[model samples]
Target: MGRWEPDARGRLLRAALELFAEHGYEATTTAQIADRAGLTKTTLFRLFADKREIVFQGQGELLALVTRGVDEALNDASAWDRMVNGVLVLSGAHAHEHRTTGRILDPILARSPELNERAVFKRSAITSALEGSLIGHGIDRWQAGALADLGIRAYYSGYDLWVAVDDSSTLADHVLAQITVLRGAAAQALEAAAPQPHPAGVRSADG
Candidate 1:
């Protein structure tokens, strides 16, 4: 029997990232990842579906956290508020501890088209989870979808900012800054798209 190991999933993820960075993602194998993590292949398979899964682990937990954050928001919270709450909740759980992993994983994904595609799927899943939560809580589907897109965009852009810089600011702080930028951009878009009244003396060709 194998002795108990704490944080096996995290260990496996870190090991996989380290290996993929040192070697290449395509050259790496599950057996090697398990071995690097100091566990058997069976243990790795128990935790992940396959080698690709190791790269995309913790998604279930993140989706659950997003739902929890949205659900826990005040009943009267706006859609933006609910989405921000979810981003905050998810980011808080990750925080600065995941930076090293991010720094390694980013380049790995960039170099591999397969991993990049998987990342997009994971991103969509999270957005859908957030959207569903908002709609379940009485938000209109249109608004929920739009807010989910915006929120996810902010979340990822914030993560990139966090990983690229060496700063003491938390992930939540970065996410909030991105949220502010997105909100301002959205406001500007709305204003630009709104109809502008013409001067009384100005008659259009169509008129």
Candidate 2:
């Protein structure tokens, strides 16, 4: 069961997202957010630098969860397939934990340029972390980075599509279907490239 008592931080983020969805970003103020969260304005600032940061506090955790799953699982034949498939397996594996994440992330990205920029940056970081994981598994730096970003964006696109569709479609199925599409693309892209035999040459990646 979920905790009955309020979690100040969670409440803050949820309130911010709710308000962002209801009133739009520019019009939502710290005081309004505090009122929504049942927190004082000072406490909101104590937890976040400003209103913008409120939308992004768990971003590192998101990247870490995705990257960690990919780093530990490389059974797929090609690094590209692994990256594309990671879009599903890693993200789906954590759907429960990230359930509220999309609710918060989507609206903020939709309405605020600043939040959209932050989302882009977060996507870049996820891409970089995923690329580093691929590089550790013997893929070339530039190729790994490009494909990682591609896979993440593909997942993002699929996720939005899923949301726009009926709620009957689960996020996992949506991402998984997109992962399949991405994997098909990766397989076609790598068909002509000669396989490298040097995972040993790569450096370790952070979790």
Candidate 3:
């Protein structure tokens, strides 16, 4: 192996995923990942904080995309539009490319409590960034938070389905589909919960 491989960071990430899937996330070590990548542990450490960081290497880029999407949304856009736009940006930025990695990481996450917790934390951070960006765009804080949460839910639900299914649709398409479904469901639930009006020309029993 050459001392300087092209795309060393990518090589490290792929190597880590392979190791994690083969030996479980909790069982894999930074040294093993480095060795698998044909790089020294120092090289791996330089590229990533640790083994866990390797799985979440795309976190910063995804969050940045969401922030930029929300910031650039039209001032008059609805909260749902702003939130969906951010999610679409994130999906477009890395969804297809990260799908395989996500598939590989999913089982590992399910087997490890620490990694699962970290994954949840990363998701929360992404939602926080989305909410902050929406708030900066003049949306109410509460609405922004709710929109961000819904966006995150849509993204994850879509990503999971996309990875699990044998479909050709892009990640952005899957996310949009999930968002539409979620919106419809929410509307249905709200309608079901709303108070029914009295019959025409008739008063309610209490009235």
Candidate 4:
């Protein structure tokens, strides 16, 4: 068996996880992770260009899943429900479910001056991808854009709170309830904006 080389990628992932959890992200090293994985540094480099890349591979899959969910929502769900569901799906479920990988990436990125500068740019990439998916949902362009922004903000706010509180409430449960509130607010706003009807005789299509 190749031992270190047979499953280099799996070894890298496990090594990175253990090292990250034990020594924290920034303190951990690619060489150390490679060593722990029973591989050479060159093999590690061949498998992964940099340490940060290891933490981010999952995001590509998740973003794809989110896009698929958004696209599927176009056919059947109400505009509001689709947007809401998209929001919920993007956030994922537990801290471990959607957050651990990002969480690991976040602190590492934050502490590095170079990575910090690029963080917003990376986030914008995801936001744009999501915006495209929202537009594909048959929502008006402006409303879809606003819904995407608002949904992410609300979903993340709830997500962060849930994480901070350490409560039993699931992320899905929390986000679904929040969607009802957002729907209510959006409905109220639309209702308030509807033109008031004139008395029957006073009404005219245009004149």
TM-score of each: 0.94, 0.74, 0.92, 0.66
Give the winner by TM-score: 1 or 2: 1
Model 2 local distance difference test score: 0.75
Residues 1-207 of candidate 4: C-alpha lDDT, one tens digit per residue: 354447677668777877877787778888898888888889877767798776555556656755766776747787666766666676663455444454554565555665565556555655666677878766788877777666765665666555555446777666666666776888899899998888877857784
Model number with the top TM-score: 1
Best prediction by lDDT: 1
Instruction: Show where candidate 2 strays beyond 4 Å.
Output: 1-5, 74-77, 93-108, 183-207
What are the lDDT scores of the predictions, listed in order?
0.90, 0.75, 0.86, 0.68
Tell me the TM-score of model 2: 0.74
- Candidate 2 lDDT over residue span 175-202, tens digit each: 7677678768877888858665557767
CA RMSD of all predictions: 1.7, 10.2, 1.8, 5.6
Position 28, candidate 3: lDDT = 87
Worst 10 residues of 2 by lDDT: 89-98
Expressed as tens digits, the lDDT of each residue in 1-207 for candidate 3 is 674878888888888889888888878889888888889998888878888888778788888999988877788888878898899998888646677777787888899898888999999999999999999888899989888988999998988988887667888888899999988998999899999987799998887
Q: Give the alpha carbon lDDT tens digit for every residue of 31-138 in model 1.
A: 899888888899898988888899898899999999999999998998889999988898888856698789888999999999999999999999999999999999
Regions of candidate 1 where Cα sits further than 4 Å from its true position: 1-4
